[model samples]
Target: MVNLQVCSFNMVGILFLLSLILPTISGDCTCDANTEEKHNSAALHYKLGAIASILLSSVAGVCLPMLGKKIPALRPENDFFFVIKALAAGVILATGFIHILPDSFADLTSPCLNQNPWGNFPFSGFFAMVSAIATLMVDAYATGYYTRLHFNKQANAGELEGGANENDGHVHVHTHAVHGHAHGAVIPTESMTLPELTRHRIIAQVLELGIVFHSVIIGIDMGASQSVSTIRPLVAALSFHQFFEGIGLGGCISQAKFETKSAAIMATFFSLTTPLGAVIGIGISSTYNENSPTSLIVEGTFNGLASGILIYMALVDLLAADFMNPRLQNNFKLQLWVNAALLLGAGCMSLLAKWA
Candidate 1:
């Protein structure tokens, strides 16, 4: 027979394992904030509604602005478009700082991870800084590569002054032409110059990449959650969030003037990402475990990187570009309005953070 001391040690081991696997019966632990309880059915209902609202809002917001071809007021040339861009930039900024960054901090620093290295080192902020630096490197390199592709030595004299009037300038790369060995597919420039159009295209795609990652994570988060109180407020906040993002992306797409197919595909993707993520979360709710250290690490890392990308894009590509534009700067009144619009958008998203 086992001795009393040995039996006691075995029993303690079993209890310790049980504690790790099972939800705390009573305590302040909130790592499993989305665990299903009495509100399972209601939460699922709210989640479905969220899927619909998020899809519709994003689709409408993006499509309406893309209709700039049909509606003069929607075109980028309109002075009011600057205000919209500012508003969207603000939304993107708040999403990075308020909505996502804090969440990363929560996940990485959760009590569940008290024993992990994540608690010892500031992994989230470090990853975020790295992400921002990487984005800048990619942005600069891509622009330079494309710039060289578009300009010839003959046209190099007026490299900045890109136009066919420069003779050999027509020899420059087509937005749809070959760059290196890859599809030199380029943005169709109509009102805006080729360089400007290309920049917008790059910005749109990079921003989309960040959005896609962030969207899927949040979708799973909402899907895995089983709290009606959380899901209910989340729906409205997410809808508005999608709408604002859609508008911003749509404006970029419109400016880029991509092939009709490309534009539609992008719009569809932006609209569906969150809803799909939510569906995935719901499907996995039975098995989803946020308390797992691995899940926390992955989510926190991705959110941190995504927040960095978004913060960089909003500040550098969106707000900084427009704010410093000659037209907005030359007109102080317009600058004021644009600044006000940015504040309004940031304020709205920041306010929504309470519920989201």
Candidate 2:
């Protein structure tokens, strides 16, 4: 966890540094003939409305699975939940590969960059590769650290003599029961222990951290824009963006099964980030220049980092976990259906990148 946090913070710092360098590296152009006073007015109004839609969609998406806990079909172990998670994983994967990476390439490769470095090399691919490698390091380190922590907790619990062994540590003992005429073992009491809950909660929180970074950047970009022609279509695209992203986030939050207060806090945070970004954009509109060289570098670098984080989380944490689970592995038909769902979600999100 410490390593992961360090790597993530480093990425954030690199992005911040890049933002600072942009204005110095790039020169501004005269306003386009199409950028009229009337357009600015329309853009402002549309921005305010867009902020509202993003906030609402984010809330609905994140909260849906949390509330669905009451539904038997939507419970974590249920087949329906499995399919939903697979679908969410696909959405996240597409957001990273199709949406964020392409946007980064566009910004980094813009004619605005100096001909020597920006024009000559593929910084987009380089950044993406660095981010991916960094993510792998964090993921490996964090998992090992957490697993050790679990072992330590179990050791501490074992030291206590008959002191609520189940509650005292992260390890839970399972008893396999045999029924008549059954070839394999059949045990019914498969309750999730508190330690398992802790792991899931940790995963959810880390995932949210990654999602929020990109969310705020997207919101800031939307808010700082002055083009209604650009902002108008984005309003609809972003609404769905948040909605699909929310579904991905919501699935993790649901699995964590945080207490009501924690759940509400997480949901609210996800919902407010984009709108908060817009509000910030409105406040700083006078100073913020989206097309400025400085802005592009900053935004592009951050988007690169975010793309890496989301892709890693989606593929490693979300997709691999479910796809490799014994439940999916043992059931061929269910696995086939999940693969289809994954494709469906990825396809839908990829299609949206056309307009967004």
Candidate 3:
């Protein structure tokens, strides 16, 4: 009798330890450990499918803007182009605010975390504040570096000019006059010179970094999720998500005016990231725990950082740069329409969070 009691106690102890390792109820329900394992296997396949779908959609979305060079309607100088870019920016802004940040909050505040440090304070706000500051620093540094480089280049050019075009030469005279005219334009115009081109390049590079950060994280999350029912909806939602994100990035790339090869490479990189991330996640899913302490910290930090960068880019680089231009400000009706378009874009993206 005593031996039987000891055996029963040992079984209970083992069960308790198992519960601590993975909190699960022993049942034939859908969410049981065994069911989850099976679902995770199916989810892996579905995630791959989602990755392919999103990659294709991203390619299509980005290619549309690049190929629009053939259409005068999609020209950079057109009013419609401005509206489209603004809408894209709005989507990115909403993505940072609505999607990623909220997910970070949910993960960081999950019941799985220990109550001592995790439950003691507002970690999300603190992390977000740090990220915002870090983004501002990066923006300031990049802009300053480029500005200094431009000044040095101009100084060197002036030195070279002293030996030849001591007076206003043919190219110099034309350029000087055109620079004046460009300044007089209603837009917040800059001398359309090498410096301007350099600035655009820097902006595109940084924007790409910001976007890829979030894209990979989302892809990994989807891949790691062990639920086929959940993964199926994400497959479609993420396709649309990547498509719109591609449009936003594509518009920025268009304005940057990179060389053909460089532009194509950038677009391809964006298109491939989410899918590549899904593949990576699949390979590491056994070791990658979304709810693990390390994962929660890493994901939350990245989410905060990505959110800050996207928000800053959308507000300062995209919206402010255009909205503050004399043309946009002076045209009341166009401004109204653009504002409506912005709101609509943000609304649509935020709504996607319901499923994605």
Candidate 4:
């Protein structure tokens, strides 16, 4: 987790530095057209409306899954919960591939960015691949480190208890590993262990980072635009699509099973980030240039990173982990439902992206 955060922050710094050094491309006379600051009251009204609607939708969608304890049907332990996870995973996958990745490509390869570097290479895809590898490294290292730490503590405890036998720690660790892997060739997701819960927690945090990154970018785009026609469709589209993202993130938080305060914090963070970004963009709309070299590189790079993290989590952590669980393997009917739910979610999000 620490490694992941560090890498992201570093990427941000690198993008910032590149933006400073890279020369802007003068694509056409119209490239300077947007530099003029014009305040439109109609656009402002729509933005205010958009902010309120998006906030309400985001809060409601995310809070729904967090209410699982009170609403037993939605609880993670329920067999139906896998269907929700599958749906969420599909939404995230589509968001990465259909929405954010394309946006990154457009931004990095925009006419406003120089062709020498930005257009010369597929920087968006390259950064996305790098981010995915980094996420994998973080996932593997964190799980491995925690597993070792837990077993070492257990070994020490046994030694302190007057040489209480625990198979010298190494053999016990091997046995535990074997037992974990032997569940009908399924991952032990249904069987919650300390390590499993910790893994879920990590997944929640990493997912939040990716979703929030993309959310803020789009929110800013909407907020900074002064065009009423564009903002109108975006207002409805963003509010509608963001609800799916909220549900996906909320489902992960539910699986993590954080305490009340921590869970609420995560939920609120997701619910507010886009709105907060909108507010920031609204404040700076006078000088904000979506087509500027600085904005393009920064937004494009972050979008690339976000796409990678989200894609990795959706494929490996959520879908693969849950689909391979023994519960789904043994229940053919449930498996069909889960897969269908995934398709439904992906299709819904993809359809909505046409507007957003």
Give the CA lDDT, 0 to 100, for residue 131 in model 2.
74
> Native-vs-model 1 lDDT?
0.77
Candidates in order have lDDT scores of 0.77, 0.70, 0.69, 0.77
Tens digit of per-residue lDDT, candidate 3, span 121-188: 76776776776677667666766675665456456656656767656444664464456334321111
Instruction: Provide backbone clash counts, one per model.
Output: 4, 2, 0, 0
Residue lDDT tens for model 4, 1-356: 22334634653454344333322432242454555444589999999999999999899878877888789988988877888878878888998999999999998998887889998999999988998999898888877776676567556655655454655655655555456444311122455776786688778878887887787788778887887777888877778777877887898888876656667877887888788777766766766667777778888998999999999989999999989999899999999999999999889888977677
* Candidate 2 wrongly placed segments (more than 4 Å): 1-38, 160-199
Error of 4 at 19 (Å): 14
**Model 1 agreement with the true structure over 1-356: per-residue lDDT tens digits:** 01223433443343333323322222344656544554788888999999999999999988988988788888888888898888988999999999988889888988777655778888888888999999898787777666665555324545644654645544443322434314334433457765676687778877877787678778888887887877888898999998998888888777777667677877887887788778767876776676666667767887999899999999999999998899998999999999998999999999998888
- TM-scores of the models, in the given order? 0.83, 0.79, 0.79, 0.83
lDDT of 2 by residue, 284-344 (tens): 5656766666766777876887787788888887898788889999999899889999998
Q: What 10-residue stretch in candidate 1 is worst by lDDT?
A: 18-27
Quote the lDDT for 336 in model 1.
91
Question: What local lDDT does model 1 show for residue 6?
Answer: 46
Q: Evaluate residue 165 in candidate 4 and report its C-alpha lDDT on the 0 to 100 scale.
A: 60
Write down the RMSD of all candidates, one decimal each: 12.2, 7.5, 13.6, 6.4
Name the regions of candidate 4 deviating beyond 4 angstroms. Answer: 1-29, 32-39, 163-191
